[model samples]
Target: MKTYTRITLSLLTILSLSACKNEEITPNRGKVKFETVSISSKLAGRIEKIYVQEGQLVKQGDTLALIDIPEVNAKLIQAEGAITSAQGQLDMAFNGATSEQLSQIDGQLNAAKAQMDFAQESFNRLQNMFQDSLVSQQQFDEVKMKLSMAKAQVSGLQAKRDEVTKGTRFEQIEQAKGQLDRAQGAKQEVLLAADERYVIAPTDMSIETISLEEGELLTPGYALFNGYKTNGVYFRFTIPESRIYDYNVGNTLTIMNPYTKDETQAKIIAIKQLAQYADITSTSPLYELSESIYELKVVPTSDISGQKFFNNATVLIKK
Candidate 1:
C-alpha cells in the first residue's frame, strides 16, 4: 500500500508542474485591427437611394448613394440663363450698332437740322422787327430761345451719330468679356455641385455602417458611411511597462490567430504609452494597477493580401 501511495503522489506532482509550465508560456493576447474611414457629403440633401448595403465591398469610384438636391437643378438653370444673357451682351459689345440704327440716327439728325433752319430764319425776322419796334421785347426773347434750343438739339444728334460710328469702347468690350467669364465660372461651380449628388467611394473599402436610410435628410458635412480600408489590417497589443522592454519598434515577431491557430510574420512598427485606461486594447486585465501600459502597433511583414482579418478579432503574439 505504501508503494502505490508513492506512485500516485509522484504522478500528481508531474501533472501540476506541467500545467504551471503551460501557463508560463502562454502567448500575449492582442487584437486584429484596420484603419477606419468615414464618408461625408459637402452639401445637404435627401438620400434618394443607397446602392450598397452594410458589409458590402466597394471599389474606388463606385456610387454608394444618390442624393436629391432640388436646389441644385434650379441653380443650374439659373446659371445657364445667366450665361446666355452674358454671351448676348458680349456679342453686342463686339458687333456695335446695326445698319438700321445708324440710318435711324441719320434721319433724326436731318429732321433736327430742318427745324433749326426754320427757327434761325424766324429769329432773324423777329430781330429786325424788334429793331423797327414791330415786335415786343418778350416776342424777340422767345424767338431767340427757340433758335438756341434748335442749335442744341442739332449738336446732341451729331454727337450721338459720331459715337455710333466709332463703335463700342475697348473698356466696354473688356467689361462684357469679364461678365461672360464670371457667368461661365458660375456654371462650372453648379456642375460640380451636381456631381456631389452622387456619393462616390474614394477608395476600395468595406462598408461597416450606414448612418441614414433612403428618404432621410442628411446635413452637410455629416458622415453618411463608416467603413474600413480593405488593405489596412494590423495587430494591436497592450503591454504593461514591466514587460515592455521585451518588444521594440522594428523588431520582427510571429502573430497568431488564437482560434484558427493561423500564424503570420509581423514587425513592431510603433510602441507608445497609452494615455488613458480606455485606450488599452487587451481582452483581459493582465497588468497591475500601478503599472503603466504601452501599445504595440504591428504590421504584417509578409503579403497579407489573401488573408482575411476582422476588426477586434482575437490575435496573439508568439514568443
Candidate 2:
C-alpha cells in the first residue's frame, strides 16, 4: 500500500507541473470584429417602404427604403415654375420690343407732326391779321403759344420712337441671364433633394439593424440603418503593458477561432493604448487592473472572403 501511494504522488506532481507549464504558454485571447457603419439621410421624411431586413446582404447603390417627402415634390413644381418665368424674362431681354410695338410708336410720331403743321399755318394767318390790324394782340400771342406747344409734342414723340428703336441695354440682358441661371441652379438643388427620398446603400454591406418601421418618421441626420461592411473583418486583442512588447505593428501572427478550431494568418496593423477599461474585449483578462492595457489591431494577410466571421466572437493567438 505504501509503494502504491508513493507512485500515485509522483504521478500527480508531474501532472501538476504540466498544467502549470501549459498555463504559462497560453496566449492572450482576441475577438473577431467587423467594421461597422451607420447610414442616414439629410432630409426628413416618413418611411414609406423598406426593401431590406436585418441580416440581409445588400449591394452598393441598392435602394434600401423609400421616404415620403411630400414637400420635395411641391418644391420641385415651384422650381419649374420659377424656371419658366425666368426663361420668359430672359427671352424678352434678348429679343427686345416686337414689330407691333415699333409700328405703334411710328404712328404716334406721324400724328404729332400733322398737328404741328396745322398749328404753324394758323399762327402765320394770325400774325398777318395782327399786322393789318384785323386781329388783336391777345389772339396773335395765343396762336403763337399753340404752335410752340405742338412743336414740343412732336419732339417728345420722336425721342420716344428713337428709344423704342434701340434694343434692351447690355445691363438688362445680363440681369435677366443671371436670373435664369439662379433658377436653373435652384432646380438642380430640388432634383438632388428628390433623390434623397430614396435611401440607397452607400456600399456593399450586411444589414444589422433597422431603426424604424414603415410609417415611422425619420428625422434628418437620424440613422436609418446600422450595418457592417461585407469585407471589413478584423481581429482585436487587448494585452497588458507587460506583454505588449511581445507584439509589434507589422508582425505576422496566427489567429484561431476557439470554438471552431479554424486558423488564419493575420498581421498586426496597429498597437494603441486603451484609454478605458470598458474598451477591453478580451475574455477573462488575467492582467492586473492597475497595469496599462494596449490594443492590437490585426487584419488577415490574405483573402478572408471565403471564411465565416462573426462580430465579437472568441479567437486566440499563440505567441
Best by lDDT: 1
Please report, in order, the local distance difference test score of every candidate based on alpha carbons.
0.91, 0.90
Best by TM-score: 1
Each candidate structure's TM-score, on Cα atoms with residue i matched to residue i, is 0.78, 0.76
Off by over 4 Å in 2: 1-26, 107-160, 276-289
lDDT for position 207 in model 1: 98
Residue-level lDDT of model 1, residues 92-183, one tens digit each, is: 99998899999999999999999999999999999999999999999999999999999999999999999879999899899999999999
Number of residue pairs clashing in candidate 2, backbone atoms closer than 3 angstroms, sequence gap of 3 or more or interchain:
0
lDDT of 2 by residue, 110-169 (tens): 998999999999999998899999999999999999999999999998887776578888
- For residue 102, model 1's alpha carbon misses the true position, in angstroms, by 0.8
Give per-candidate clash totals. 0, 0
Worst lDDT run of 10 residues, candidate 1, spans 279-288
